[model samples]
Target: MTDKRDFAHIETWVFDLDNTLYPHHVNLWQQVDARIGDFVATYLKVTPDEAFKIQKDYYRRYGTTMRGMMTEHGVRADDYLKYVHAIDHSPLEPNPAMGAAIERLPGRKLILTNGSCEHASNVLARLGIADHFEAVFDIIAAELEPKPSPQTYRRFLDLHNVDPTKAAMFEDLARNLVVPHDLGMTTVLVVPDGVKDVVREDWELEGRDAGHVDHVTDDLTGFLQGLLAKG
Candidate 1:
């Protein structure tokens, strides 16, 4: 995490979507995962326990289970995306507060996510903030490389013409933000109270209590407002 005082120094802002876009209390991810689990159970013919483990392992090995299935098992990316994000969007209503926060942010805003473009777009549209970001770089943009991969971060910088010193990253996943921190970009970990409940153990290795992160907060609206005020 970079110093809050350095907020004025950044000229670009990058954000991770999903839980970071709205409060984790929304329980949006759980719904998405249920779809993934269902797909695994049916396709792999595995028990729920085995499906979960296999999903985790695939994510660990290929940065994303979709990528793992694509490379190892020849699963089609479009087919995988269609299957996983086919959930009902009715539960994910529009978030005016989140949209307002996005409007308040400084510099260019970009959505960086491990999910595919289709998934990202559907979520953003459901949240009613599809127009907030200047660009949406999804898993497909990264060539299927997911978060926590230094190469994906590098590609992000190159593709977007983002200067590390002039940018800050807001991510719910601490490990995913580590590379950005190492590369001299400000890192903000958005751990909204019980938001850490669903985070995996290995991903939560450093835990949210570590003071090394530039900033930790439960409220993204407050954080964005504070940055604007500081500037």
Candidate 2:
């Protein structure tokens, strides 16, 4: 691990919502994934298999499936977001330990996600850590733009009045950290534990060099705890 003191100047903590905050094994995103596939299948009159391919293709091309759908097919963003996020959040167990770790961190905490604010709110509430964050910057807030897009990052920083040099961003996808790293923020990649055999999409895989990532950790709570200890 890089010395935690390296992050000593981070006065703002920006976190991605889905797999970064919750373990991937919890499969919370599976519900949203299936819903996206179903939406694509229904809208395009294609089989689920074909829709799955299209979903991923759009995700790769547009940073998000919804953005691709809107750009190509004129899909309504609000309805699509509501439909895809309408899933049971019961898989996310309340995490007091994680909450405590987050609380111990010094800084303004913000959730930066490509998902809807309502979805972020639901997930935070399910985790029992709703009150920990100062604000959530969601897809709508980004004007339908998504991460890995420099424009989205720029807007987020402007909306929150955050200085990238004084921020640390944690995300499950390494690609999403590229802009943050370029902006001078400390970037941490959060991967699932014991993921040797787990299948992931191309975008989910970390690059060989992973030069954009300053740190890697499987346990976000533990990582935060260590940061506090070192601080």
Candidate 3:
């Protein structure tokens, strides 16, 4: 556990919406991922097998598959965002305890997701934490550039007037925390609870040791509650 002193100066809590806010076990993101594959196959006129390879290759190369597709294929960002986000959000169950913990924290809360604002909203609403956040900085707001991109982080900071030194960022992907850490924000990596290999990919789980993550927790609800206790 990270000491309260580590985050004592934080005034803005920026959380990644997908696995950071909601438990990864909820599996809501699997739906969006499937849709991404579907989009790739349909748009590229490629076989499903080929699309899978392309999807991952693009994701690895561009930080996000959507960014890669746009760069190489000139796909409309809105169309892709809308298509990918149009999925059932029922897998997310409300976590009133976590929401309460978040609400009790000092200062404003915001969501910074590689996902769309609509998707973030749906996830937040489903988790019953939408009201706790002051605003959302999504891929659209990021101009289709995703996290880990220094420019995207800078754009988010500029848009929100957030001082990195006074902010803390929580993300499920270790890679996404690099820029925030570089900018002086406290970065907490939210890991999946129990049997991670079953729920996450090898690549997504590879960056825990790159020296950027400041804290880690598998239990988001307990971690937030613990932060409240630390303070």
Candidate 2 stretches with Cα past 4 Å from truth are 1-5, 195-199
Total clashes for model 2? 0
TM-score of each: 0.88, 0.95, 0.95
Off by over 4 Å in 1: 1-5, 195-206, 210-212
Pick out the ten consecutive residues of candidate 1 with the lowest summed lDDT.
198-207
- The residue-by-residue lDDT of candidate 1 on 1-231, one tens digit each, is 534425777878898987788777676777777887777777788999998888878877777778777777778887887888877766678877778877777678998999877878888898899888899998888887788889999999999999988889988877787788888888888875664555334564454655436888788888787766776
Tell me the TM-score of model 3. 0.95
| Segments of candidate 3 deviating more than 4 angstroms | 1-5, 195-198
Comparing 1 and 3 on lDDT, the stronger one: 3
Question: lDDT (CA) for every model shown?
Answer: 0.79, 0.90, 0.87
- Give the per-residue lDDT digits (tens) of candidate 3, residues 1-231: 543328888899998888788778877778888999999999999999999899999998999999999999999999999998899998788889998999999998998889988888788888888899899999989988898799999999999999999999999999888889888999898887876433667878767656788888899889889989989
Candidate 1 vs candidate 3, TM-score winner: 3
Measured with C-alpha atoms, the lDDT of residue 166 in candidate 2 is 97
- Candidate 1 local Cα displacement, residue 95, angstroms: 2.5
| Angstrom error at residue 98, model 1 | 2.8
Candidate 2 lDDT by residue in tens digits, 19-51: 989987887888998999999999999999999
